[model samples]
Target: MSPAPPTPAYRRLSVEERRAQLLDAALSLFAHRAPEEVSLDDVAEAAGVSRPLVYRYFPGGKQQLYEAALRSAAEELRHCFDEPHEGPLLPRLARALDRYLAFVDGHGAGFTALLRGGSVAETSRTTAIVDGVRRAAAEHILSHLRATDPGPRLRMTVRMWITAVEAASLIWLDEGKQPPAGELRDWLVEQFTAVMGVTAARDEQTAALVRRVLASEDG
Candidate 1:
């Protein structure tokens, strides 16, 4: 009998490695096209594998592939939230927020895909992911505040401040990413520090007025 041809290097990769390779290719396609529009053949071609091989990994088909991509994105986000932040709370908060923004900028398509995938049915899970990140940031802020300014209302105030930051970040990203990344980073720190009683509120009010004027001109 004739000797069988050796398997390709990619095919020789471990199951986990192969799955990750397929997902990376699938994610790139999803970025360019919506999940529903991506075909198995397209993914196979992108991954340099056969249609049957793609099917073998994704037995249930395109939906399974999509879920895998979405899950990967979500897990990455969750892991980011679990990172440790050292130093004063406000600085830590700023760093965390910056990291989150950077993630969104780099992975906007992944974020969009996970959000539109329709698999994340639990509102609490979404809130947990969102609020969990903010809470970690807020904790650092609150810790820094308590080190100097002891108060009864600081907790509530810090929570509100974190909520504002989370909302502002989403708005900033959604509305054309204005103010540039550096400016936005400064603004986040200024806003958080002001809330913690380190900086004056006048600056924040002034910034708000500027935003309003610019928004009016755009409209």
Candidate 2:
């Protein structure tokens, strides 16, 4: 064998790149462990950097890093419901749920840490971040329903479904993700349809939506 090849020199990352690397490491740690349990040292080690280096990028320390990580996760969760308008509404919703559930599954304990709301790392800003995700998801669903300016009943129905999705997601995690994800997705779609049908009985807007959905399905 030839003599050991020359090792490449370490390349320096730009400020943004280095910050992103730190954030990714922090997020990964936060993904499996509660933010309160994770430390700045852990993030530094995970990123293969020194603790001082981590502080250099995040002067506010672990709280700052945790907030940043929460923001990143929140952005991803918000995008999960941003499905295209081309498909049947249920199918679109199913696809969005697939993405959302996948995030929940991947994040595992992190999902609980973010949503459970009693962690030491929890802050008003972080709470707002989580709320923003819920609002964004509701908006996406409303848009998919073609309800640009939904009335109180329609809006409440859509928001209720969103809350149910969150509750079901938490329950799924507690149940160790039993019944499989596809089954969960289908069940959620069914639940949405059922809830909308019940609401339609008393709400004209929901009734019109049900008729449109039925026509689409019949077609």
Scored by lDDT, the top model is 2
Q: TM-score for each prediction?
A: 0.60, 0.93
**lDDT tens string, model 1, 1-219?**
997776453458889989998988888887656576789999999988889998999998887787676566656554544435344344444566677777666665555544443433224454455455556555655443432342445556667776675566556656877778768877977775565453224344334433543454355
- The TM-score measured for candidate 1 stands at 0.60
User: Model 1: C-alpha RMSD to truth?
Assistant: 9.4
Ten consecutive residues with minimal summed lDDT in candidate 1?
198-207
Query: For model 2, how does the per-residue alpha-carbon lDDT over 7-39 read when each residue is reduced to its tens digit?
Result: 321348898988888888888888788888999
- How many clashes in candidate 2? 0
Name every residue pair that clashes in candidate 2.
none
